[model samples]
Target: MRARSTVLAACAAAVALLPAGCGGGEKADDAGASASPGAASAAPGPIPAIKPADVKPLVGRWVGTAKDYFQFTADGSGVWVRGGQRLWSGTAIPEGGGKYRFSWQGGDLKTASYWGVSLTEKNTKLLFAGTNQTYTKAVAHKGKGKG
Candidate 1:
């Protein structure tokens, strides 16, 4: 209870620092009218099925905030890095229809973790369990006019 109170107080303090109710209220409708308070939110769209080709595009280096790195190889092998150190290495198996079952030996989730496909963003997939966060693909830059 004490920890909860402290966290709530911190959140309240943080919210107070922001302007006017922490950016809530007065959501606009599709017809350019204000939505009612406590109105039902829009439903999320369906997750698309992933293909082997989709997984192929993700076979590269990906970098996220705080030195988080994700790498996938063509030969069903991959690596995860944090703070310039190897965090996890495992094999990725395709379960058909754009989903992958990640299997790691000694890591966060030992058994397996389900991954879904994002058609809009080809490089990254949604982590369904443990934590919900998007892992972004790392972009490589080349010198101008130098192959």
Candidate 2:
């Protein structure tokens, strides 16, 4: 009877330590392993779609500066400059294919014309071309009188 009680006490002590030794780490590892696959399979929400009709009316005059550059326009033709050097002066025309193309004289150099197409939105898109001292810039047409 005495030996049986000693054995039972030893077993109880082992069982108590069992949870402390194995419970926390194994449970955390299993949770982390299972959680990773679930995170990977989760889908991101839908992307916003833009159509040509949505951008048509924006084919007028827009004047705003971006990235420390300034633009001034009358009608669809405009000039852009940065740091007191003229970059380009160009005409913008809607190309009927959800895009607008602009042609302009690049810098003070005659016979140097640059052209590019851009999709219009409530926001403007600015494009930069060339390296170092040689570059061209294009902006989307923004509409109406200034606010």
Q: Model 1 Cα displacement at 29 (Å)?
A: 57
- Deviating ranges (above 4 Å) for candidate 1: 1-54, 106-128, 144-147
lDDT of 2 by residue, 1-147 (tens): 775565445434423432222211111332223211112332222212334344444444333232223242334444444445444344444445434333322111111112333433433543322211112234455789795
RMSD, one per candidate, in order? 17.6, 29.4
User: Can you tell me which runs of candidate 2 are displaced by over 4 Å?
Assistant: 1-74, 105-114, 120-147
Query: Which clashing pairs does model 2 show?
Result: none
Number of the top candidate by TM-score? Answer: 1
Q: In model 1, which range of ten residues has the least summed lDDT?
A: 20-29
lDDT of each: 0.43, 0.33
Return the top candidate by lDDT.
Answer: 1
